[model samples]
Target chain A: MENFAALIYVISSVLFILALRGLSHPETARQGLNFGIAGMALAIFTTLLLPNVGGYFWIVIAIALGGGIGTVIANKIEMTALPQLMAAFHSLVGLSAVFVAAAAFHNPESFGIGTQDDIHLVSLIEMSIGLAIGAITFTGSLIAWGKLQGTISGKPVTFGGQHALNAALGVLLILLIIILCAGESAVIFWMIALLALSLGVLMIIPIGGADMPVIVSMLNSYSGWAAAGIGFTLHNNLLIITGALVGASGAILS
Target chain B: MSAVLIMAGGAAVSPLVFQLAIFVMAIFVGYYVVWSVTPALHTPLMAVTNAISSVIIVGAVIALGAADASGFSKFLAFLGVTLASVNIFGGFIITRRMLHMFKKKD
Candidate 1:
């Protein structure tokens, strides 16, 4: 069953690659979107069939709720709000990454990582980085969304010692990561999440309206890497491949 | 040192190593393919990629499916699913709308 699932995942990955390839030309872009939809559908179906999967009652409900809201928003949003919508979507991806990392950290063995008291060192590192990146992406995208929506000022917001503060936070985060490696502590984990969230806001606020598009794309890339970091923890190849593809796409566009 | 070299050269590479290799290669593939996209389609490209990136939903589903998931973990997983679903559905719908607009012009 595992092998069969892996085979299906492989086919889905190929379809995704073809989807991006198809997007290279205007004539084939719509076809590319179809391929992407097909790939996602196949991936979700295969995952549902995995041996470890449990009941689907809540999962169905969640999808319906979110899907219904998403459809309404997509149909109603103005074209002028495309950037804002992109930022909003990117923020959700980031938040989802953080949530998944937290879930895995709470139950490592179920994720095939390790037990709570003695999680694998590599897995721990991956989770920490994932959590950090996810937090950063989440808040950063939110700020970007606000800027695009004109809720936040479009001017570059800079204060005294901005770079120094950002650097200090960066060093502190690294220190926390090292401490986390020495011992697994939930407090430290949550602290990392909080600090990263602050750092995300600090990092984005300094950029002005003119550079918002670049920042948006950069956050898109960060979201991809956040997903990839969690992918490492989950040991899922499809996530890793898709994350890398998205990351690289955003990098090139930015 | 020689032993380390021999191990590195051996066929018994770890799964993580294989995953890293695939990850790196996929980046190159993405770089090339994304570069070829026309500027006219940039918005739609971003929209479609946004949709595809929600493939992270698989991870959320795994969390939801775990037998031993706690209430807190389950709640988090549920939120993850909802958020990703929004991206997947909203992203595709918007991209299709934009593409349709482009088609109408041609």
Candidate 2:
């Protein structure tokens, strides 16, 4: 059974790679998207058929609600705003990873707790990456939206010594990360999160309107990598591989 | 991680397959929705679309938060935020430019 699942997963991954390739050219982008969707649906169906899926009611509800809302938004949105919509979608992906991590953390026992303070490394990795990336993506997306909506100026938001400020923040985030790696440090996580948020703001602030597409592509890749990182943290071979593929292809497309 | 185990057990589908399916469906759904609703929106509807797209980023980030990952995973989360902001705002600018194209001299 696992082997079959793996095989399906592998094929799906290949499709994703191809879809991305197709997406690079506007002419084939639609077809690529179709292929990608088909692949994802297959994966989801397989997931639903898993043995321990006792909570069918909630799962169904979530699928229905999410799908309905998504459909409405997609149909109603305009082409002129396509770029913004794409950005928002990327942000959502990051947020999803974050939520997944949180859920996993709360259910450590279900994640397979070992004796003698057996910390689930995979779970920890998932939680850490999810939280950090999720937070950053949330703030960044908001800023992007604001800029698009003209609630905020599209001009790069920079001040004297801004680069230095970014450097300092980067160093701080790295330091916090080191602490978090050694053990669970909620404080470090909080600080690093703040730093990342500020960094996100600063990074976009300096970029001009012409660079939005590049920024969008970069972010998509980041979100993909974030998912893959979660997959790694959880020791989910499928997630890591798929996430990496998404990230790499997105980079190539950009 | 328990998360991995849970994922491993669930429906046993491949990520590639699932994501690809989602992507294709999104395009179709997006096209259909736009076709149906374009006439209903005012010319400035582009503004709303831009806003909606930004909101989607918020949704995606929220979703990622729901995931089970850490360290590098968290770092990657920032990528989405950065991208969404630029994308939505960039569109907003383009819309303004397009509008300018139609403006007659005072």
Candidate 3:
């Protein structure tokens, strides 16, 4: 039974790959989307059948709510707002990883903040990544949204000393990562979280409006890499493999 | 017997969903095909659809990755990202082509 599920998973992954290929052409994009969605549904079902997938009610509820909301948004949102939507997707990817990492960290087996368990390490890494990526994705996406919606100037945001500020923040984030590795610490976590959000804004704000598609693509790739990192934190072989596939493929295309 | 019942249920539902999905896909395929045939409105239509496609990715990633917090959830997150990447890449290629059409002297 498990083997069959695995087979379905593999097949679904292939479909996803093909769907993506087809999506590259406008003529075939809708069909590609349908294929991708169908593939995802299969993947989701396969995952749900795992032995550890406790409680049926929550899963069903989530599916209903998530799917319903998604359908409505897809049908209702205007074409001009699409870039903002893409930013929103990046933010969600980061948020998911962060939440999962938080949950795994708080699990009774680990030190809640810091410990040496492989799973905990994975969770922490994912959490840090999520915090950083999600924060940036949120703010950067908002900026992108503003630009697309005509609320903000479409010109790149820049200043004489901007790069220097980003460099200083980068150094601080690295130091914080090292500090978190040494012990279970809350202050350091908050510090890194702030730094990550700021980094996202800095990286994105300077990009020109004409480059919105490229920026969206680049952030999409970042989200994939962050997911792969979270997968590492979890020790789930499937997640690791899938995440790696996504990150690598997104980078290639972007 | 339990497995048989499960298989039967799967058989009953998957086909129906697949058919519906295909029908939905056909609408898009046909729309784009017709749009492409009309040189006058192609660029504007493509531009509009490109934006719609981007939002689809966002919605997919968020809906799939929300709140379940399982290993499966992580996998879904990755899937969401990949799907979005696909949408963006595909959308851009079409956009580039559309813009190129304007650049060339007609």
* DockQ for every prediction shown: 0.73, 0.05, 0.04
Which whole-number lDDT from 0 to 100 does residue A178 have in model 2?
Answer: 66
Residue pairs with clashing backbones, model 3: A122-A233
Best by DockQ: 1
lDDT, candidates in the order shown:
0.88, 0.51, 0.51
True contacts kept of 2: 0.01
Which residue pairs overlap in candidate 1's backbone?
Answer: none
The interface RMSD values of the models, given in order, are: 0.8, 11.8, 11.9
lDDT (tens digit, per residue) of candidate 2 on B1-106: 3554565677966654444444443334333333322221222223223222232233223323433434443334334334434433443343344334334321
DockQ of 3: 0.04
For candidate 2, the TM-score of chain A alone versus the native chain A is 0.84
Point out the higher-scoring one by TM-score: 1 or 2: 1
Question: Which stretches of candidate 1 lie above 4 Å from their native place?
Answer: B1-11
10 residues in a row with least lDDT, candidate 2 chain A: A108-117
Q: How many clashes in candidate 3? A: 1
**Best of the candidates, lDDT:** 1
Please provide, for model 2 over A1-254, each residue's C-alpha lDDT reduced to its tens digit, 9 standing for 90 to 100.
54676577666555544544444443454455455555555555554454433344434444455555555565566657766765666666556555454434433333342211344544454457656765566557656766776678888877899989878877777667666666655565566556766767777777766677667666665665666655544444445555555455445435
**What TM-scores do the predictions have?**
0.96, 0.65, 0.63
lDDT of 3: 0.51
